[model samples]
Target: YRTAAASASLPTFLLVGPSGSGKTAFATLTERTSIAQTHTSTQPLTIEALLPSPHVPASSHYRSPGDPAYERSRRFLLLDTPGHGKLRHYATASLSDPKSIRGIIFVVDAAALAEEPGLNEAASYLHDVLLSLQKRYTSATSSKGPTGIPVLVAANKMDLFTALPANLVKHQLEKAITEVRTSRAKALRDAGAALSGGEDEVDEEREWLGEGGEGHFEFSQMQEIGTSVSVVGANVLGGKETGSVDGWWEWIGENL
Candidate 1:
């Protein structure tokens, strides 16, 4: 029981995104070092994985291989949450629970992101995730503030010819999230007015995402809220060529 408890306390990276976005594929690959066929996940899955070679965990940079500290530093947990809209309570629980969460990896299909529905879906989910982190940061009671959580937007499916480049993926998501933020604020105002008969003003600042003003929303705004968002492109199951996901692993290592 003591051994199990110690293992369960390892730093965890939450894997979340829209369905069919390669979240399972990436998770499976990270655990087995090989891609495997996957079906749409219906529940959250947690797996223990180690940092592969040539890449070093930030905490183990000075420690050489074979050292106990270096080996322990490579050990961490990857929590894969179902991306389906109706089943996101699992992710919500993880986010709300006080655990050893280190970072979040949001996987998205680059090819699908080209369409309106896909972009909107990804943007909405991402907005909520970032807002949760923001709320957590602001609600902390510590004088020094809580440890900030970083986010990695893994733009997957680059092997497909229709996929958007990494830069466009970042831009498109930012633009779509701006629209989502505006619409959400409007809805909140309407609901608040209905409840108070327009006698009370809504707290737009609390509901608003990023900085105030008509300016576009950028990931950099998250920096002020104790979260750093990074968009990195990689494919987990490339045909004819080996898939590349080293960048994501490096990001995970840095956070771990």
Candidate 2:
């Protein structure tokens, strides 16, 4: 039980995204250092992963490579949650109580963001994740606020010719999330009108993600809530014999 307790306390990074976005692939790669055949996951999988060498964990940069403390600092857990709509409660559950969570790695299929349906699906899921973080930040009882959780928008599958570039991916998601935010507000207002109650006003404000206003949603707004969102592009498969995810590892190391 002591071993289990120690493992449970390891820093965890939540892996979430839409179906077929390579969340499992990345998890597999992190565990084994090579890609493996993956299927649509219906349940959450937790794997212990160590930060690869050459990239140093931010917390242990001063320690020598061979030091035991340095080695321990490189250890963390990757909580890969199912991306299917029906199974997203696993992801939502983790977000709701993220005590040991170090960060969130939201994988996205770069090519899929090129189409409307895919873009909208990804946007809606992402909007909720950000809003959850925003709610956590606002509802904290401590004066200093809860520790911020950063999000890495991992733009996977860059090898595909149709894949949108990283910059475009960021822009498209921001624009789509803006539309989602607008629609959600309108929905709340409509529902409140139907109910004819003053209590609904407070709920609407709580539901709104980021700053309130007419301006479109930008990831920068999340900084106000102590969350930083970054979009980095890399192919988890098909780029070469071994797909590139060095950028992702570096980001993880930074957070670690």
Candidate 3:
């Protein structure tokens, strides 16, 4: 976790997750549209689109909503990325670029797991996206930034499909998270070695970590941090999780 010093600008966070995983909803919650505004509108608002590249006009705009809270800040730019399976394809590149993202919020839909078609599949894809993003962020940084870019694993929409155990989901995700962390730790080690003075970058020596590298992929395990909550989510976050109630405030403050 990295905090923006008092003099520094507020940290900008980018939201990414599978379709129907409520990435947009989580953004709405973070933006705090309802409380920030006199009332909440059902209408969908345009959240703005990001081009594949930073320069020039956006060829397209992905739609997301905004109310008083989100509009209040110029810093938070949540990318409504396309859903998983296919969308996950672009994530590695986007994250590697660094120019487009500051922090990543990987949303997984807990309620969707039981559903037959969309929800379950979406949930699974979202989970994979989290794994990939977690790996990429760790790999790119290797803990080198002045303030490390934070990644929040958001379990969204716990209001539905309350049956599945948290342990189960965490089990499936563990391997992926470990791999990413391992890759990143290896990257950092290589970067450190490369910085040694008066040494030519060696081909074989750079391969020290093997293809992906070594170590473990980990985060303060996934947290239920979105505004809209499920019975399952409420039970998990409100009841057990340390940061559920004030999760956003604490996380934002820490990562800002």
RMSD of each: 1.7, 1.9, 13.7
**How many steric overlaps does candidate 2 have?**
0
lDDT of 2: 0.93
- Clashes in model 2: which pairs? none
Which clashing pairs does model 1 show? none
Clashes of 3: 7
RMSD of 3: 13.7
Candidate 1 regions with alpha-carbon error over 4 angstroms: 239-243
TM, every model: 0.95, 0.95, 0.45
Tell me the tens digit of each residue's lDDT in model 1 across 1-256.
3388888989999999998999989888877745688999998999888888888999988889999889899988889999999999998889986347999999999999999799999999999998888878777888888888899999999999999999999999999999999899889988888999974378777678888887799999999977899999999888537358888989998987
Better of 1 and 3 by TM-score: 1
**lDDT of all predictions, in order shown?**
0.89, 0.93, 0.42
The ten-residue window of minimal lDDT in model 3 covers 224-233
